[model samples]
Target chain A: MKDETDIQTPDEALEMAKKSRAAAADAGKKPLVYHLALPAIVGCLIASFALRDGLQLAVTAATMALLALVLWRVRKRGVWVGNLRGAVSYLLASLLIVLTLAAMFAIFWLKRTYGLDWPAAAIGAALFPVMVAMSLVWEKLRHRDLTGKMS
Target chain B: MTNPANGLEPLFNAPTRLQITAFLSGVAEAEFAVLRDMAGVSDSVLSKQLSALSDVGLVELRKSKLDGRQRTWAALTRKGRKSFAAHVAALQQLVQMAARAAE
Candidate 1:
């Protein structure tokens, strides 16, 4: 609407750029619930693996339903990041997936080999904090990237 | 004439537009109200700038119903993202150049 050719000196341009970066970082910030949602889902799924055949299915179904609800609420929040972008983001996400799968497998192994009663629940509990830490790290890295602090 | 070699985009010369694009760059889509608040501009001002950006195919707007009320959302087009990234790179370059010149 205003004049398109509004020019700035180098210093002003730099400052404006910095301000823009700050705005982007702010826009990207999410609530604590967003950070906690996925880990909670994963923790439930891991805990589900320890259940009896019928209960495992039920728990798995419930976990998926919860995931759907979380996604719906996120959409209703009016701002969506969709997925983190860039190679580093992809790498971290992939690492998280691998870690989750490994945890589940470890639970299975412990249950079969040692007939442990607490393997699934214990590992699932451990994963909640680990996943939360990873989530926080991912957010920190994403913020750094958004703010142009990475380079 | 603005020199193309400087890598400063004419479209982003306006600070409001630059700020809007920067915010859009971070999110996939944002509600109109959220963007308005972030930009700290009047609805008319933001609408005008968004319209300008839409005209140039830099951004897209969508309307949807939420809680039985109409809402608008905005996001950068692929072109917009590429352009914004280039503009940021150019700005960084300018800063670097200034530092080198000072040295």
Candidate 2:
């Protein structure tokens, strides 16, 4: 097996070493996805609580999954005590989306079963997917840069 | 055996040093704890390697204090960065040459 140590050159090796350090520091910053998605996540939790009987648990699971995904991303691509972190971010993110959908479903169930009005539920429902999709796209674009300092 | 491609080898060939360099390469500067974690090495081992790299003028170590605790940060000197860039280029060249030879 080819280990990183087997690679050659005094200078190139040094560059990789330095890049690893910068990568660590940059990884410390939370992804933009997390920041933007926070509001939608909060909305989901709120809606889930109001409609707990139907989809609350599922929504809650989705939120947990999303959080786990973000952390996974940090662990995988993000720097850990030097190269130990693997790439579990994608899986975690998927969990979050599922959680969000669950919450939306709960709201749907509530509107149908209860007398909840259309406008509020419609607005909340619309916001969740848009926010999640935007967050995903933003992270994909930002992470392409190795430094993780997009700006 | 040597790399037959460009007659050049990777610099900072050692594991510890490579970890250190990789960590430093991404940052403007880094403290001891930072590098320690990045390299996944003990204090003493990392310290020894840093000392050697510093001796070669490849790294610059500056000491300061954080909340009354002494702090040491490491950075690559200009010569060090240049050397690293050249080393990487050489390795790439070697890889390319080797590929061509195989073909």
Candidate 3:
């Protein structure tokens, strides 16, 4: 379509700007929405299992709360990390998934090798920190072009 | 009290275009994919609007390699930054006055 920026008068232009900006801002609000809910549910669920069946309910709740806070804090500051359309992003995502799976496997391995018999919840609790760390590192490395300090 | 809208650039007149400009205003520059998601437009739609924005010199679109990957990035020009600031101030004033009236 042709440029629609050539509307007749200032009033018309301003009105259009307001409407367009509102819509765009709404679309960009994705980070805030999922950052609020998903992190809490995922964090707590993972922590609950990682803590094994042995963690007190209060400790589990606290761990979940802590993980949720950490996840929210690590949210991409401006651009959406997931919107990246490069091979690098795909690599970062793959690395993150692999690391997470690896963390889970490590828990199983430790139980098998050392005869630890770690509970599922304890394993999940063990993986939480590693996952959170990987997420932050991956996001930073994922959009280094956007987030990296200007040279 | 100078006509705030007087400072409004005609280049940002289109709402979707305006939205794109607004998103670019906050950052140094952003990738096409990132901006497309922020603008909430289909790929072709955003490319068109971005070209329009570029034509008016309100935005700069650059294609380059980052971390061994090719990407298109957009940044608001100096003119765009000034124009958008004025527009936002005007909007804030309007909102404030409206709040007073409702109260």
RMSD values, in order shown: 3.7, 11.7, 13.5
DockQ of all models, two decimals each: 0.45, 0.16, 0.09
Top candidate on TM-score is: 1
- Which model scores highest in DockQ? 1
Clashing pairs in 3: A49-A121, A50-A121, A50-A122, A50-A124, A50-A125, A51-A121, A51-A122, A52-A121, A52-A122
- Please estimate how well model 2 matches the true structure, expressed as its whole-model Cα lDDT: 0.59
lDDT, candidate 2, B22-42, per-residue tens: 556544466788777776678
Candidate 1, A1-151: lDDT as tens digits: 4343567765676566667667767766777887788889888889877788899899899989999888778767777777586788888889988988898789878888998747787788888988888888887877878776522
| Best-to-worst ranking by TM-score | 1, 2, 3
Residue A38, model 1, lDDT: 81
* lDDT of residue B60 for candidate 1: 97
lDDT (tens digit, per residue) of candidate 3 on B1-103:
6665565565565666776876675455667877677656788989998998788787888886654667787878887777787766665555555667789
| Pairs in steric clash, model 1 | none
Query: In model 1, what is the error at residue A100, expressed in angstroms?
Result: 2.2
Q: What proportion of the real contacts between chains A and B does each prediction keep?
A: 0.55, 0.33, 0.17
The TM-score of the first chain in every model comes to 0.78, 0.35, 0.41
Better of 2 and 3 by lDDT: 2
iRMS for all predictions?
Answer: 3.1, 8.0, 7.9
Please rank every candidate by DockQ, starting with the best: 1, 2, 3
Highest lDDT model number? 1
